[model samples]
Target: MTDRTPPAPSLAQLRALIAVADAGGFGEAAAEYGVSQSSLSEAVAKLEALAGRPLLRRTPGGTVPTEAGARVLTHARAAVQAAADALLAAQEENGGLSGTLRVASMRSAATHLLPPALAAFRARHPRVTVALLDSDAGGGGAPAVRSGRADLAVILADEAPDLRLSPLPPDEYLFVAPAARGTHPVTLAELGAAPLILPPHLDSCYRRIRTYLAARGVSLTAVSEVEQDSVILSMVGHGLGVTVMPRLALLPLPPGLVALPLPEPLARPLALAALPHRAGLPVIRAFTQAVLSHLPVPELPAKEPGPLPVPVSAPPLN
Candidate 1:
């Protein structure tokens, strides 16, 4: 003899059970779902057959769930709510913008660049939540977006094809030194001659400062490598050494540090990256719009031949 397996309950069956409990009768439940009373009854009957137990009782107090029906309806209500939430998420992708977004970013950019953009984003989309995750330039982000740990990442425009990239402002490299050194618009060759503090050569930038120097017949001398941009900026501010890094990295430079734009700017394109399909979602669109609307690509200023104003709002490391 061949074995026959029962089919699992469909969404229709589950909805019928929950509606019947709420509306208290097959006719009322059918009206709620815009279906015929007979169809609703049949759907509940299928649920009972699948569970191998009766799920409803006729009582003077309209229609009531039997003990078994009460238990099954509890699960049915939960499943229904989950379905509604799933649909709501899909709707949000279209135009229903109210959900939390998990965002990923590298340490330097997160500390210096993202704050203003995020604050602007919050001002615009007060209902949306953006959770930022700090990552090493080369790691932490890939696994995050791939494993559903993050919805978006701000990374270099051309770094990863899998992460669909949308352009933000490209960040230009700057020569950073102690203010007491009295910035006189130092050239790359002059910067190379100073005691240098720097981060390890990284992937998004590929040792940006060094690569540019290599191209210009310059080389590091009396150099010290620190692993964090914030630390490097701090070291440079303290007059230990001078360093070259993205202008965005030394933003709001500490009390004693100063930035000089390179004569020939060395820069890396930064962009919003996400699983290709996620780029168009409403929350992501909102974030990207906020970024574009606020942070314009900084046009390199004329070389400041003297000490400029120190930004009082700079973060504490320096």
Candidate 2:
């Protein structure tokens, strides 16, 4: 008697299945996979054979996953996402110091801390393409880097892993209010009296602000919840309400706004984090070095924590 073992499904077969399911048909899926319809069908068939069952049902209206297919497809999607990340990492590794470098950060860090560093980094490695990601567009940089979608990420000290932090100067807290109200340091009691415009629960800065206040036995009564720090600043400028954010956020304060140091100075530790396993990649390694070199330049002269009419161009989101 002879025993024959079935072959495991290949990544290509798995991707073909995922593409077909996502695109909802063999024709579209084939286009997505850059293969002919017949070839895609063959790949899916091979995958289904390995599972010893039909993975998809081809109804006239469209292709839908079979009951078992749906369960397996969940795993397939994860596998595909993982494979895509691996492919990206492999490409970066193979490209030496001159391929795409994906970066994700909150708006302030992206606007203030990153611009000089990026300019200097580009000057040194002109061949590398820099891709910047914004936090609100998705969850944020930390999640992006964790999932391998980005080479580097800027994250708050609280949410970041202890091992990977390339710490930056702590970002100090500030009281921001409507431009009409004007800028001046406000006491916690005075701040509590107003209808506060607070950052949503999701923001790292929100947690920082909340934790700082919580330590002082104060809790915010939020009148409005805003997401983008820029929008929050804009709302303050419009006299919608008052809010608290980091000093770095004041770089591009809106036309009519007041930013003041809180009566009690509160700051959160900030860092540039990267996966230690990716240190061997030249692009990430070089960028980390370049940022470390460029992050600590002396601050330009600034007005004493009030609306000084500083301006900046709009930055792109990834």
Candidate 3:
């Protein structure tokens, strides 16, 4: 009698699984990989057959990995990344850099921080393609890098302790309220006077602000929790309430509003995150240098010794 053994999964199948999971649906994944949905689905089906278990589940929200699927995905991502690195290494040996460098970043950073750096990197390594994935959720960038969906992630500093981080200048948080309220360094009392409108509790910036205020014996609750920075600003503009947000998110502050320093200054530190093992890759190194070279050092507001009662001129908005 001859023994029959199951076929080993191919790298193509592994990549298909990763793509579906990351993209969150068969149609989207197919579009991204430039393959038909049937082909992508077949690849994942084959992978599941080899493992003898269901890997993905369909839901109203989107396709998501099942528990077993999630476990397999971690290995799939590692395997796919390793294969890419091997290919990249071979290409680098020829003294040329050619491949995609995926970067995950929050929307604000993507808008304000990455353009110059990306332009500089493209100029230096025209052969290498750069993909920017917008991750709007707080600290969403770190998870994308950890899952091997991105080579680098622009995120809050110290957001992921296990990942290697390259720190960038911090973005100061400012108190924003109606211009009718008058422009003055906000007192702790005034901060609590208005019904607070703030980012969702899951937001890293919100957590930082909450913690900082908690330490100072200030406990305030948000009357409305919003995720979009622009919406929050608009809400404040309409006198819904006041908010504290990172300076980068409040740029070009809407007309009829003012931003002032908090009674005690606070800031959100930013960083580029990468898996420790891949931190030394030539492409990663090149892009890191580009970011450092092109990103201007932010001019943070000077720290006040204490809250001032007199109104101060609001900083110029550009």
Candidate 4:
């Protein structure tokens, strides 16, 4: 009797599966990938046949990966990324860099820090495309890199383990109050005098501030908890209450508010995060160099170890 074994699935099939999962439907995935819906459907069908299991299920909302498909999807992303890295390595000497580099970043970093770095990168490698994924919540970027959805992420230092980190400049947390209410170098007692306008309880920044203040034997009453930085700033402008926010988040401070350094300064530690295995890839290295070159680094006091902030899961890819 002859032995019969199915051949391994092709790269095309794996990519098709990934696209479908990402887009949440065959038609949308095909449109985004610039391929015919029938072709994508065919590729996924063949992939499922080889695995001898259903990979996707259709619902009223859209298509989603099955239990088995979710397991396979993880490996599929890794396999695709490995192949892309190999190709990038081979082409490094032949011509300019070309490919998409996905980066996940917090809102403030994206708004204030990434523009110049991205400009520098584009100047050198115009052929490369940069895709930004929003990861506003603290520690959110780490999961994007782990899932292979983003090649690099700007995340809080020590946010996740088992990944490579390249430190960026620390952003100082300042005491923001109505200009009429304070002077520079506000004391802890003065900070606690007014109701504090803070980010929501679940925000990583909020947790960091709370931890730092608790260590100093201080606790302030909160007047309101808000999610949007702009809204928080607006409220402060109207003298609703004072807030403590990272300097990066207070950029272009409105006219009516004053951001004073606290008597004992607090800063948010930040770093670039990438998968340990993929950190050295040529494209990632180039972007990392661009960022490091463009962002200014200042002398900062050594960071003291503190309680770890809770890790928030990245939202599912759409």
Itemize residue pairs with steric clashes in candidate 3: none
Instruction: Summarize candidate 4's per-residue lDDT along 70-177 as a digit string, tens digits.
Output: 999999999998888888776572268898999999877887677778887887899999998898743489888998888999998867767899888888887887
lDDT of 3: 0.81
Residue-level lDDT tens digits of model 2 in 1-318:
766775677888988887888789999887776889998899999999889999999898899999999888877766765564465556453344466788888877887788767887787777889998886576877777765557788888678674377888787777887666755557888676776777787666767777777888776565577877778777777777788877777776666677777878788788888877665456777788777887745344344555644555433422
Q: After superposition, how far is residue 191 of candidate 3 from its true place, in Å?
A: 0.9
Compute the lDDT of residue 263 as modeled in candidate 1.
Answer: 60
Q: Estimated TM-score per prediction? A: 0.63, 0.72, 0.83, 0.86
lDDT of each: 0.72, 0.75, 0.81, 0.82
Which parts of model 3 have CA positions greater than 4 angstroms off?
A: 1-7, 20-32, 36-42, 57-64, 91-94, 137-139, 219-222, 300-318
Note the clash tally of each candidate.
0, 0, 0, 0
RMSD to true structure for each model, in Å? 14.3, 5.1, 5.1, 6.8
Count of backbone collisions within predicted model 3 = 0
Residue pairs clashing, model 1: none
Identify the leading candidate in terms of lDDT.
4
What is the per-residue lDDT of model 1 for residues 198-220, given as tens digits with 9 covering 90 to 100? 77655444366677778888876
Question: Over the full model, what C-alpha lDDT does candidate 1 score relative to the true structure?
Answer: 0.72
